[model samples]
Target: MKNIVAAVLAGVLSLSLTGCSVFQTLEGQTEDKPNEYSNVYELSSGKAYVWEHDGETDIRNDLSQDRVGDPVFFACPLGDINFKGDELSDIDQYPRSIWIPSDIDDQIPTVTSKNALIYISDTTVPEEIIFERFADYGYSIGVSNMEADGGGHYFITYAETDEDDYKYYVDMKSEAAQVTEFDTIARLYLDKVGGMEVNEDTVSDGGTVMNLEKDKSYICEFYTGTFYQDFKLKANIHSFGKLERFVCHDYEFLHANCIKIEIPDWFKSGYYFVQGVGLFRYVTDEDLLSYNGKAFDPGINWNDPIKQYDEYGVCIFDPSLDIDYEDIENISDPGLDESEIVIGASPEEEEETEGSEIDESSEGSTLDSDSN
Candidate 1:
């Protein structure tokens, strides 16, 4: 009876070990499959391509003009505009193509030129469904400046349709290095503006607010860069709870050509604490009080009331400034105090003023105050 009992115990132990081994093997296999399909391709032009499979067919071919199942590539023309297909070292490298899922109900990729619009129908489905339905179809897509971070990578997809209208979609995947870099720059700017404590862990939410402001600024800056010609940041003040504002001045030769942007109020002030002291301190802290011969008064209000004339348009403050309710009534139509105004003098002007022993007060008030 004792021998029989020992035999039963040993048999049970052997079965348990086998079950443990099988479980581990299956888990490892599942993990390995996804990694196997993942690929990263680097082109000669300092651009990188990263992709993961959704269980679709993997084939490489050049169909540049055909527009059927051919891979499409997108990039910013700020740098090089040429595509060097021969320099790409990957054996599977192929010209970029537009990707279309076979199962999409619309049978066509949604496209839009408006930067504010988002395409959702194709991206919301399961990866397997997207692959089985769309990837099997010959729709190759092209995207530019794709960014990824903790949230995910986003790429704008553009496809040429039979109707000559280009369809746009945003393709998302795992966050990559490029997205992280932009996030870092944005966080740094927020730290400068709001003194917010941001690190990798808290960045997603904290960085999002900063990103929206920066994106708006970026758009405004881009427009300024293109249309306003030679505009530069003059005085920028960000306050808590809808009291944020920034000013830009355009210069031509030795005169102030125009005042470009005047953000009246910032909307995200309630989310963070921005004291008037911060803005005053920033000016004094940066020692911007003395640019050329002119000095700025940190105690006075920074809002400009003069509606100056410029060739392109009336130089007035941005209407968004009305969002700040605290001092909105007081600043509704504030005028520029010429005594408090500071004109940036050139190096030559500085040298001339220094040589002549002129009084600093007289030089400070020489800024042109004519509204025209």
Candidate 2:
């Protein structure tokens, strides 16, 4: 009877151990589950926090409050804009509103309304170094001009950033206007290149660069207004590896505050090589001008033969409009037979052509034998 009792006790102990193992497995799985709020944070008054499992509790109140003094931080919300400090006010001074032209050729309608902010602050480097780098990257600074607006003096500066870079108009009136104009232009250029449209109503304030993949990413931020109720502009320029994103908000900021203007794309890609390399002269080289020494010739190859012209009858430089070199050659030459152009043909057509040739040869041989 004692031995039988011992066996039963051992069996019970074994079952208990197995049950404990199963419980541990489940607990391990639960522990390994992903956290959804890994990248989020919160702020109340001046305190900031990192979101954990128990909701927003203070992570540290002792963090430096210098960032709060910055105008960029003041224009943006705490959680919406990312910074390296705790202070909400010490952020950089960027512009808050801008104005763009109402319309440009195949491009979407230019933004004429005032809806942007700008901040102008010196970078960690010198101005000469920055200007040199800008020029090296296929961007050039043309002019520096100042004007009086809104009872204050505003200065505008222009720089080219890339090979197909769009124009950037910097407003140096105040830190707010400067930053606002920069963000607006950056966002506008980015939208133009990425082929994305901004839903004006859904725009928000603050800059957020989201990592969609290990290498692929996008930047979304409020180009105008405060972080809470601002128009948001998002750009995914990294998707196309070679292109840089340009975003802009206001055009009047360029016209009124701008000290310089970058040449339009049509002139840079289509006309620059054809014409001589004079900076100020290229600015006045309009496509509609008569062929005098003062203006560009109308009959010259001024327009891009490859791109489809826009509503204003201007050539658009979209990579999606790229065609085969042979097809472009055929289109360029008037004497070539369009039917003989082997551009983007299907494999089935190639096979059909071969079969037709064979059939024709066979029929010719049969007819010859019958005649003999």
Candidate 3:
């Protein structure tokens, strides 16, 4: 059976921590939190979660559930995978809502309209992640942006036909581009890519197919709304792998299900997905050909394309063990200048220990990270 509804996307950004033990539960990390976002922080195997803010739509309210599963833990596969977290001082440094593996069960505190109470766990529950036709998949409300010059970039969704309609879609005369809002651009792109008149109230469900059965192929229209881009992809689930654990970097995701999707015999690229986590891994025939001693890109003649699908495979987060932060500040002060704030270390402590040797970074550090 298929369920249809409006869906949202929340991109996953892995956090970089030093050598830390796997899966460290933060007991009192939220003790000093002042708001719901800070107070309800969770510690899980997720390194870090990065997402964009869409309109006032709360994804949890509009989540489509074909089965009695936890839709609140939905994840999207588009965001700044390159997002760098300077320090883990403030819990609000990340997205409003997050999913963390936990053993605690209780009524969650109410978050503001701008915040979401989305949480997830790696525990394998009886409910399955069902993919339906026209239903809105749950993830945090991720928003995308269209450049002022009519240039649009998307990840999860690609154009079905190579039409130069992007120039026609944009109104160069207006100060704000014709495709300003995320939904407007998303629908327009979806109409072209998914080959459906998304503007129309009723859409034709001609090629929509999704049962999520292993080794079974199904043609489906997948929609993605992430921080950088919001669009749809029309592809076939070539095969569904058995539910297993997906370990990336220092974090491990339990009950991780894999789905192999492709664009039939045309595109030579492969997209992979996890049940709870959206698109986690991707592969390409070009890289495969090059790995097998074939010229992948003749122009560039790039042989070692960073990854050859064998060394570590395609996991979302980079396996490097380095901490990175970019213009990080307290969530409350948006205009505050970026400072070098370390987790569990105050300004005075940082200054005092500037030249002194400190202990190594570990999972049991100050603040734990979360995923979408």
TM-score of 3: 0.17
Quantify all predictions' global Cα lDDT against the true fold: 0.22, 0.25, 0.24
Query: Order of all candidates by TM-score, from best down to worst?
Result: 3, 2, 1
Q: Model 3, residue 84: what's the lDDT?
A: 23
Question: What does candidate 2's lDDT look like per residue over 1-372, in tens digits?
Answer: 999999988877787877755455556874422211122121222211111222323312212222232121111111111111322222223211121111111111011011121122222211210100001011111101222234332222222244211122221221112233333321221121122232222212111112222222223222222232222222211110001111222212222111111223332212111011011112223432443432223344322232332222222332333333345443444454445444323234456676888999999999999999
In angstroms, the error of model 3 at 366 is 80
TM-score of 1: 0.14
Full ranking by lDDT: 2, 3, 1
Cα lDDT for residue 242, candidate 3: 17
**Global Cα lDDT for candidate 1:** 0.22
Off by over 4 Å in 1: 1-73, 77-333, 336-372
TM-score list, all predictions: 0.14, 0.16, 0.17
Q: Which ten residues in a row have the lowest lDDT in candidate 2?
A: 129-138
Alpha carbon lDDT at 146, candidate 3: 20
